[model samples]
Target: MNETRERIALLSKALDLMTDRPIRVMEVCGTHTVSIFRQGLRSLFPPSLELVSGPGCPVCVTDQGEIDAAVSLAGIKGVTVATYGDMLRVPGSGSSLVNERALGRDVRVITSADQALEIARNEKTRLVVFVAVGFETTAPSTASVILDAHREGRGNFTVLNLHKAVPPVLEALASDKNIALDALLLPGHVSVILGLSPYRFLPEDHGIACAVAGFGAEDIMLALVEVVRQIREGRPRVASLYSQAVREEGNCLARDLIDRVFEPCDSSWRGLGNLPLSGYGLREEYSSIDALKRLEISINDTSPPSGCSCGEVLKGKMLPRECALFGRLCNPSHPVGPCMVSSEGSCAAHFRFSRGGDHPWKH
Candidate 1:
């Protein structure tokens, strides 16, 4: 703990020495968002350095159309929808998975994709659709499960593939002139799958500094220090501070598995529109188990709630509290938007940890 404090102090000093101008560093991982709030890292930073949350939470960033499709699929007879618990309460056009489940739809909250496969294997009469939603960190596990189901001949098993790639979204954000971002605190978990090579575009193409950081206070502090140092020294590059788990080349086996099962395709994010080659879809070989293809479900684009600013929040253009419905009508109990529904969501994190201060930097 003492060493961690020392590192934090050093990071504070580095922030002071870095520049007088305000620097906005976005952390594009939900775990990193929660870690920053849980460890009170925001209070430790100088006012010049602001930490903004991006569209990091997969459940939070999932398009309303996709959620509506999943909800619609759940209402179909002989179909059992399986997904992580976080996706249950996300409001779609008219209903959520939770709402459908209460209406007697078979919605199963699963821990792994394999559990959904098992359900399909045992319940041969029912169709099990695993709502796969995540970045590259979790995609490999889903890929592995798909391979297992294909080998075992689980005909009833399929996945609503909402798996997104991080690098392309980051590139989209970097290229956008509206968001004034100085550096990015890359996701350590995703970096473990993609390694350092994928993030090179941030610095090489966009002139942004990046650091792949772990979830610890010390790790985040060290990453911030490195980012500040790079900016101060005029050297923008992608550096990995989570060296214990991440490598330059990343996990080749995991990459190969993902490539074998899934292919890059255009994907729609909640706030960010359809990004080219930003999502993973089941390849031709895996079409037998692809739910979107087999079920022929029609997805309609749905708008967010009337007063919710979750889209702006996801894009880092607006803070959670800045939304009119943040705490008044958008608390955890009755969430009006995905940002409030997700545990790793910026609104949820701010509501739980930073609500007292109205503005985080002011505190």
Candidate 2:
């Protein structure tokens, strides 16, 4: 604990001494946002260094239209919808998967893609549809399971592929002039898969400094220190602070699995609209197990909730407190938006740690 304080003090001093102009850095991973709040790192930052949460939470960034489609899929006869637990309570156009389950629709929360396949193998009478959602880290696992189902000839198994790529969205964020970003704290897990190559464009094209960081407090701080240095010296580039896990090339076998099973398609994000080649669709060869193809459910656009500012929050345009519905109408229990419902959501983290209490890291 004493060591932690010394490290924090050193990094804090480094930031205070180096930072002159106001620097806006976005932590572009939901896990990073949660870790920052949980470790009380918010109180330790210098006033010139501002950290904002990006659309890093996979569940939070899922467009409302996709949620609605999942709900629609759940309502089908002889269909069982399986997805990660985080996706259960997210509100769609009219209802969520949990609500559909309450109404006797077969909506099951699963921890792994294999569980969905298991359900398909066991429940021969019912068609099990896995709601595949996540970035590259989880995509390879989903692809692996899709192959398992196909190899085992589990014809009742299909996937509502909502998997998204991080780089395309990062490119979109970098190009958006409305949200000024001096630097970005890139996602650790996603970087472990994508490596450093995909992020070169951010610095090369947009002139933004970025660093990949793990979920630990010190890991995040060290990454910030790198960001501060880049800003101070005006040499913006991509740096990986969490070199223990992330590699320059990333995992090749996983990438090969993703390529074999899925292909890039236009995907819609909640805050950011349809980004070209931002999402993964099961390849044409895998159409036999594609949920949308089998179920014939189209992902039509839907308007977000009237007062929820989740989109703005995701884009770093607004903080959680800036939204009127944040605490009033959108607490975790009664989430009016996906940002509040998701565990990695910026609003949820703020509500849990930043509400009415004394600052956690003051000591």
CA lDDT of each candidate? 0.90, 0.92
Separate clash counts for every candidate: 0, 0
User: If scored against the real structure, what TM-score would every candidate get?
Assistant: 0.96, 0.98
**What RMSD does each model have against the real structure?**
2.3, 1.0
Quality of model 1 by C-alpha lDDT: 0.90
Q: Candidate 1, after superposition: displacement of residue 209 in Å?
A: 0.5
Clash pairs detected, candidate 1:
none
In angstroms, how far off is 129's CA in candidate 1? Answer: 0.5
Which candidate number maximizes TM-score? 2
lDDT of 1 by residue, 1-363 (tens): 566566677776776776577888999999999999977778878788888999999999899899999998998899999999999999988999999999999999999887988899899999999999999989999999999999998899999989999999999999988898899999989999999988898988888989999998778888888888788787999988898999899999999999999999999998898999999988999998888788999667888778888889998999999898989899999999998998999999998898545432222
Off by over 4 Å in 1: 357-363
In candidate 2, residue 307 scores what lDDT? 91
